[model samples]
Target chain A: MKTTDNASASLAEQSNDEYSVRITGFWSGRSELIVPALVFILAGFLTYGTATMKVMGTSVPGPQFFPTIVCVLLFLMAIIHTIQILRTRRFPHEDSEGQNADFSTDLLSDLADTENEAIYVPTARPSVTGKRKAYSDWKTLGMVAGAVAAFILALPVLGWILSAAGLFWVVCRALGSKRPLFDLSVAILFSSAIQLAFNAGLGLNLPSGFLEGLI
Target chain B: MESLSLLMEGFSQALTPMNLLWVVIGAVLGTAVGVLPGLGSAMAVALLLPITFSLEPTAAFIMFAGVYFGGLFGDSTSGILLNTPGNSSAIASTFEGHRMALDGRAAKALATAAMGAFIGGLIATTVVVFFAPVLVKMATAFGPAEYFALAVFAFLAISSVVSDSVVKGLMSLGLGLVLALVGVDGPSGTARYTLGMPELFDGMSIVVITVGLLALGEVLHIASRIHRDETAVRVESKGRPRLDLSDIRRAMPAWLRGTAFGVPFGVIPAGGSEVPTFMAYGLEKKLAARNGDTDFGTTGSIRGVAAPEAAANATAGTAMGALLALGLPTSATAAIMLAAFQQYGMQPGPLLFERSGPMVWTLLASLFIGLVILLVLNMQFAVLWAKLLLIPRHYLYAGITVLSVLGVYAISSSIVDLWILLGVGLLGFMMRRYKFPLAPVLIAVILGPLAETELRRALTVSQGDLSILIDSPVTIVLYGLLAITLVITGIQHLRHSKTARSQALKFDTDKLGV
Candidate 1:
């Protein structure tokens, strides 16, 4: 529990750190402002969408009524968040060593070094005691997202067993599993076992894909 | 005397050979899943819900009781063994339980946790058996306005008091409300946010969101950190785990006190076991200090392990009572259980007891049976369960990922649900990454529609006059509690900031003096 807490705590602190560094073509520490900005945009969109919702002639509130209330509240929160980000950026910390700036530059250097590898190499990083590093492995996260996307696209075509196996294999490899052959075998075996249990034993209809005739 | 006779009838029904087998299977499976980090009783019940479609309602609920008890019992096992709590409920247990494990008292720690859970659950269940009718009577008295106030109180308590950042917590709550508004309006019968997709007409499925957020999101979050080797503290129990006389004497009062703190939390919609466990841990720590036992946060205090584990299971048991009596689910697991009842065309309330009297009593009886089964299984197999951590992290995570996808796909058999699952999984991952507490989101999703419906009902009764909301004494009291909680949290926040400033100043002055 402490480990998970620290894991999240460090991510929060890392974003705080990111809020103090300069990204190219943006204001100082502006990279971390993206999520809040996106939230603001979403709030605007929701508010507009709620406005366009058709109201029924009913005694009580319309369907658009509750959504409009929530959208306004969301908009208020997003504005507050935006203001907070702006305030933090306006008042830069007056540290002598520029530690956060140095760390961000070092992070960028590492990112540049790993441009070809497609995975973040964490070996050369300094071990900061008492604080876990943020989840900075964006490439791995992207691969995971890609795996799920592929799974969704392939489920209808390749069937539950094959698509699920493909998902397992992709996720395992993306998470740095070294044994491809072993992972492949386990993935196939695991998915197949689920297929047999759910489809054969439980009599649930799992899509057979091209194996409809073969199986 | 009438209740006792009904309980006996329930026992007779639950003690059947097939039901007993189901109980054992549910207990073992629940424990196995609960020992895995990030999965709790809620997810275990959610995954098992589809299978129960084939079974009799009584037998199915009996199995659910086993799963619920076993999950609470096994959750603390991982917290003690690896310092990785199976769920938020076990967070407090990991504080001193892991230290106890590291100090070569792994067996003693396990014994303390299991015993505490047994005593707490047993007592809480008894409390339920005696007090459920009274609770049902109280629940019957609650009007829609009062229910709305209670929902507001729950939302405020969870969003403002439970989270590290009130803004983030409220943001999560808002997001859940937005998601909840996806379907057609219940009262007005108007389509608001379905966006022309017929699939969205029923709103988002709780199972998909939960599995996506808790299970898959956790997998993704951990995957991003997979480069680092997890430094798990593996301490095996050397022999049969047993609580000595002194251990038992020391833990008994703490367990009772913890149960006292946990029971009321169950009645209220205070989210889940996390809050009570922490409160129990804090209370026990202070009591230990008062008792001149200073070996806390260091040498591993038995009171620490006892209090939190007891409080967690106590909350679990009483939450069931609240669910059964009030038809109100205070936690995510209880919410899923409510959905299970609904699947069988049963609504759990005063009417449920009158309608399905035998099933209700049997379900309550099976909770006691499940508690005993869990105690025996966990006490004897503490060391064996610790070996579950020895599975390679990669395979374990990969396998869980497979199960997660399979579970979501099997439910409703909709590819659209899978897409929603993936989207929600990413949302959950981002929330975790950004340090937004997931509980508020979950609680809001589960409670949003109820809040909306109750509010509308209250308004309809008063012909859209908003003043009717606060007309009732129950509504006023709930709103007063919400206000007081907010003020207390505000004062605490101010004090925290002041202390932080003073500490920073003192550090600077000391450095200059040096």
Candidate 2:
């Protein structure tokens, strides 16, 4: 029972870190300080915007009333968040969980061990010599975002089906699908099916673009 | 009695074969979307809002009602099998539902969740049927000041109470309100932050914001990590799916208790299903201790799953009542539904029933129908949904990406909206990556406009008297609740920090072999 409890606890931890970007150095946790800083900058911008808004009436609340209030609130909250982040250990690396030094352990192993009691028993790895941060797969995130951008750029010229098919392939490749042939087939079939349903069946006009005359 | 007769008439209208088919379609679609991680009823409703524009209000709302309940039902399936509860409401179920799956009682756990949801949802809908009129009557008495105060109360409650860090939550709330302020002010006719765009004249599209933040953001988040690990498998259980007599006996009272936790929260703008679910789980845990049952927090507890599932569905049901009766949206899903009501060019306050009586009653009746359909579908096909977890993560997320793009593009048929979707999706990704809560942002966006309008109207009525905000009894009561909430949260925070300190000390001692 203790083992199960600990294993489940670790599973919760794993899930929490599922999409987190890893960092190194003694200031690893300090990366969290960036969000509060960004929020503070945004609050300043809102404040400036509110201050410049022309008030139409003298008696009633102006258009800037709510925005100004929210801006001030955000400014104060961001400051408080900064203070809190500074006071506490800000990074996952600083956590006392036994595996902080070894960032190369396969995530799938952690998942497979979710069902096993052995996960509760932490294995000690030698403290690493250099700063080895296993940041979340940013390359895939970039590729996916790029794919969406490409779709946006392509849609007006290439139309819905073609752009959407291209999007599907790009996303599939980013998600680590190994078979390009299968990916192409799936993307074509899926986009065409959507075209048939929404465009043909629902009578909604999807942008035909260059395919306006083609099948 | 009048309500009962009206409800019966509503049943007559809704029970037609055509509406039944709509309900079936909605339930199936809602369940399919809801089973996917990171997509809840809010996203489902938002993505489908364009359809509402083309359909009759009654049929559109019936479909939405099905989606609402079906989302809650389907969320627990993924929570049980995949350990990924998409929404806060499903978090409590993960506590013991996943444990039960690991304990080889997956079928029993699923049954408990399904039946509990049905009982709680049915009872809560009955509450709505009886109490909506009363709520409508009460809502009629609310002045602008009272409305403003209620919005403030909601904003404060969600920002300070829902999340671990009050600062982060308030930041999220602030950002949402800022987003809400982007369009031309409805009263003043001045553009606040349109950045010289005609599309910005109408403000950000809620559907675009919602689909981008939730659906696309989630897809991006998952894509970032999908290649690092293989997809996890669903836990297999040995027993038949049917709940035994003993199981039902244990779950029945807990279901009622969970409903008790949920009903009052429905009235309050305390955000979403998360609070009631945690409350139910805690209550059941204490009850288990009282009953000398030590199985909780370890292997599994049936009441653990039953109570939270009931609480979640009960909250979903009563939230609809509040939305329909008072025009208050307490959760993200309800907020989207509120947006839907707005899309129909109707405000859902005291005058809604009077202005659209038939539509409102039919919607209520369809909710009941949706509930029954959800129960049947969930019970019979839950195992089939567990199979959904077996789909490769890449394909699942790739499909979501397509859906997000399609939904956004379909709504406005504009590339500009797609651009907004991508930008907001990235913002959502960053927010999630930073552990900032998303619900506060959503709630603020939905409620911010109302808050501003009501405040301005109140001040205008009083000719700039600040005391007008406190003049009414309703406003006073709401402010009082806000104060009490703050005090309680402060105490809780203090207690939590103390416990954490002690735990840290114990850890230090253990490290030193003390």
Candidate 3:
């Protein structure tokens, strides 16, 4: 209650953060396990590459020595991380008690050096272990990913202004923007301003594909 | 007297109409980004790195200095108004700053922060004018072995101190080292991990890493979880941000003490101002408790805001000193500055003072100039800056995503780069979601090459004798400092872990530390 008394809007999460973080099944999604799994694969690849590295160095510590050390350490850390994940059975946002400890579920927790781990004073006992759950939001996320892909593929052909504007529209849509017409107008205006700033201001040449020579 | 005269010569250049404009623009832009929850000066500079490619080196650096200091000045705004710190460094300020706002002292909190930042940055920059040359002399004396030792020291200290989990920090370090190793090996001319992509012959650019990880990755992460997270609650902080005489009296000593806590960390390789700001806050809280002057957690306390704000800017100013003198960036923002230096065919080490002495001086002098400009702008317009948070999150992130891609493409004009940007953005999203410390990745990518090159060069010189690394006194001292840092961090970790395990599903109400 004392912790709840002093907490901000974000502190509301800890008390009622009943988000279902059911990352289940071997073939399904254990999103928390993905990072470690990827590192494991990367380590294996690096190990193979190190053994077969070309140009055997004439020096004492050659080109492959450092990679070998890095790969080995990567493997060791990945194993420990995997074991830790499996043993705790905790989601990314959960503490060791398997309770949601992610402050302010917004993604700001990422680069922010918050003591989300085994640190910090426990604020208050969450009176309610609520049943709300957060999902991956793959549909919207996939749309955003698709938008970036489309922009990358179409940049040279569609030009900076058009491709950038299109990317902006799709990303806005992905982020749950419903006003397509207004979004498109804002996208066009924004991209064009960037174009003007870079071209007329910075003197860098951004391609003008369909809008070529149109100012 | 010579340093004083050189500083004056720098002032002469910084006073120019053009450079002065850069300072104002950079300070304003830096403050804008710093006020946003998801943006920081590091990403702003990284996005601008490519655009600054064509500008004169001096003007670009002047703007960079402005942006760097400006971010620190503005970081406490949102913290005071919304209780949502724009970044971790401002979290310390938010504790009491927000309390002050709730107590109807929002103006006082903002004013305390602005003035504290101004004084801290000014004092630290002045110290740099005198202190950096000694550092430069030491950097000048560094041999290959000593350079390698320093890099190792930086790598170990940052990885250990920055992350709570030692394994995660090292893994992040490993990932960065792998990225740094992607291009051709300088000595052997054999590529490490390019995967036959011609665009990667030069390895990855710092612009891509910083922009992708800090800027675009954030956009993607937020988009993925847009609905799950609660929307930030903003309170309208009205009134002019003017501190009273009594407020100033209480804050003045705290400001100096916080700056003292910050300057040493400026030279240390531990990334970010988090540790220093938190320490400043902790010290102020302890002192306040001892004196019974003010209630810390319940009511508002100006000392809390003043100390952390001053510490944040103090660290930023001295970080600049570390960047210019030692060519060793002490924070992520400084790391990007170091990258900007390399992009301009200039390496920021001892040689920089001799080769581009004027530019370094101008950058340092403009820090002072930037602080003056930021104090005026922030004190008068704290409310206006808070309004920036009202921009819709979707549009804000959308703008960031598009601008980041465009900025990266502008640099090299390669389709491959855009693809890599997306890849790195995804990587950044994952890292952010999983609590991976992003500083080690940036620092390692920047320092990994130097470490490898120097290690090999030292080994080559010694005819395969590894003892050459330990033969030098400088290397010995550097490693000794690293050892001490590890021990201190380890003890801190153990103490924190014990407290963490003591609690089940609740926070430790009596204890303080976040």
Candidate 4:
């Protein structure tokens, strides 16, 4: 449904101006490098950390030995993984499979469970691409993350029942619950039920927070 | 004879009302976890670890046994009903199980799976009762060098064999080893990589690592794909899940064969039940083809569901044997179980059989009891369990998220654990997104310190001579096996990828021909 002329015009501009292109809505083709980079930096930190550790005795293998081996392995493995990502041409811009570049083609899902099947036959594009939506629901993800953060911060003060109820309600809303009023009630009922079960059956003390006297 | 008598005593202890109640609770909880997508028994055990502080060690372990086996049984329920295998072990069964459901024989497929699991678990546990003592004897002869080599073998086997890409697997393992280094070193009094935080000095808790990686990580992964992925349709199961005469006859033989295939892999630490289940499925498919049984890849065959289901539970049962005898965890669930044992201040090794004879036997006995209970639950209530999938997606995940946080917080009442849980949860989500295997990271976290401690001890004993690592016959044989296994598995991996590549080529070429 995209015009090739417009896509090509943007493509030309993209080549001239150095900018990041998303491989998929969920993941960028270039973002695969992050794990290797993180691993490399961790190895660097560990190497420095190992260097500072004083060997308590004249022991042959000190506390640093295992850590040194671990960091080295991390470094080597990171290098290998980076090389792998570099070798795989994620953007087969002119590949034989599909001459037309479909912006909405989710490469990850396409490759998944079809290792033994050819890359999408050019004939199959309309069916696959038509049904799919641009994924990576970052809004829902943000809501979930925010709810967890709020719950953790407020747990001690608001008490387990109230905070947990709040968390459940927000997460339900984030996950696509339309009825907030109904969701909150269900959340509170379940959360308080959990509190009573633990308090009565297990005798494990959860923080009562401000509800200490009331509960 | 001795173990049999000991097992009888175990039955007596396990048969008590209180212990039986705990077993029921564990089984029910474990089955619910196993049936739920994106959750595993390892996470259930991790969540349960905190409340165990108030539990008797015997009751706790009996419950852990129930949870472990219950997970294997319940994993396949989702596979048959929804084509979404709850665990990796259930993947192979989904090939035929879901097809059978689609063919309007859902009850038969479910029955076949339950029977397969029952027979496999029974035979495997029987083997474990007799065989674990011999394993413990062999374990007694193992010195520090042997244990270190075993851990290395575990690390190598898990990393290389389980994942599609070896590099990512090792990267996951490296992440775990780095975390393992956070606490005070055992050989030397040096605190390492702790970043000078007092909380980090105790290192990462196994419970936190497991829950974050397996549970919360899954929630985030689901979040990212919530809009894109459509909900899977439930194959409405009709009729009572009881096999007719013909169905039973076909499944009985396949179950035995699958158990045979599974028994050996259960002892090896090459990840979890996935491999054996896959292999068993492949074998059954080949055999069915040879026999001119045209049911596969279409309406599905009952034997197809039976074989993989058997292999999965058999692998799980014998994994418990390995955990008890050698203190070696052959799977992620077993690894968490080892952590559970440590929580009770009990180390499961050669000495555990002698010292905690009653506890070990009771756990083993309860497994048999739990297996019977599971057989009933899965067969009769097959449709009932399938109804769990209908609990609306938002509510299921939201509840899991809260439970993950609540479980971790309840353990220590520490805000620091919650913070670590959050960070690890993010890492877990990323790892899942990138397709790095989660089990190796878990296996490495639990086994890293043990491996390191043994390595140091061996070197100290040998006065820093590297030759001592391969000096003993056991150590030499273990390394030899490791070398041979790596070479063979490497060849197999190359062959598999080549086939995959060529098959893709053929599919494209055939489309052109048409």
Reference-based TM-score of each model = 0.87, 0.89, 0.91, 0.90
Better of 3 and 4 by TM-score: 3
Tens digit of per-residue lDDT, candidate 1, span B1-514: 6778888998998899998988898888778777876677777776677656667888888888888888888888888877777766776777788889888898898889989889889988988998898888888898888878877777767766756556776787788787777877878767767778998888888778878887788778777656644445566668878988998898889889889877888887767777777778878777777888976868899998998888988998899998898887777678778867876889887789989999999999889899989899889997887788777777877787778777777777898988998888888777766566676677777778888888888877888899999997888888888888789777765665476457645533332233
- As for candidate 1, its clashing pairs are A21-A29
Give the per-residue lDDT digits (tens) of candidate 3, residues A1-215.
12232332344455454322332344222456888899988988888777777764576688987888788878988988887666444343432121111122111122223334222212233232354345455677778878999999888888988999999998888887889999999999999998989889989888888768776
Q: Candidate 3 versus the native: TM-score?
A: 0.91
- Runs in model 3 deviating more than 4 A are A1-30, A94-132, A213-215, B498-514
Please, what are the lDDT tens digits per residue for candidate 2 over residues B134-175?
A: 999999999999889988887877777756557777888888
**CAPRI quality of model 4:** acceptable
Model 3 lDDT tens row, B25-129: 999999999899768899999988888888898999999888898888777898888876777678788888988998888988999999999988888888899
Task: List chain A TM-scores, every candidate, in order.
Answer: 0.66, 0.67, 0.69, 0.68
Candidates arranged by lDDT, highest first: 3, 4, 2, 1
Superposed model 1: Cα runs more than 4 Å off: A1-32, A89-134, B498-514
lDDT of each residue in A1-215, candidate 1, tens digit only: 01133443454366432111212233533344665676677677777778887766675765665677777777777777677556443212221111111011222222123222211112123343454343346778788878888998998999988999999998889888999999999999999988898876777778889888898
Question: In model 2, which residue pairs have backbone atoms overlapping below 3 Å?
Answer: A29-A90, A29-A91
Top candidate on DockQ is 3
Model 3, DockQ value? 0.29
RMSD of 3: 5.8
Task: Decide which is better by DockQ, 2 or 3.
Answer: 3
Output the worst ten-in-a-row residue range by lDDT, candidate 2 chain B. Answer: B505-514
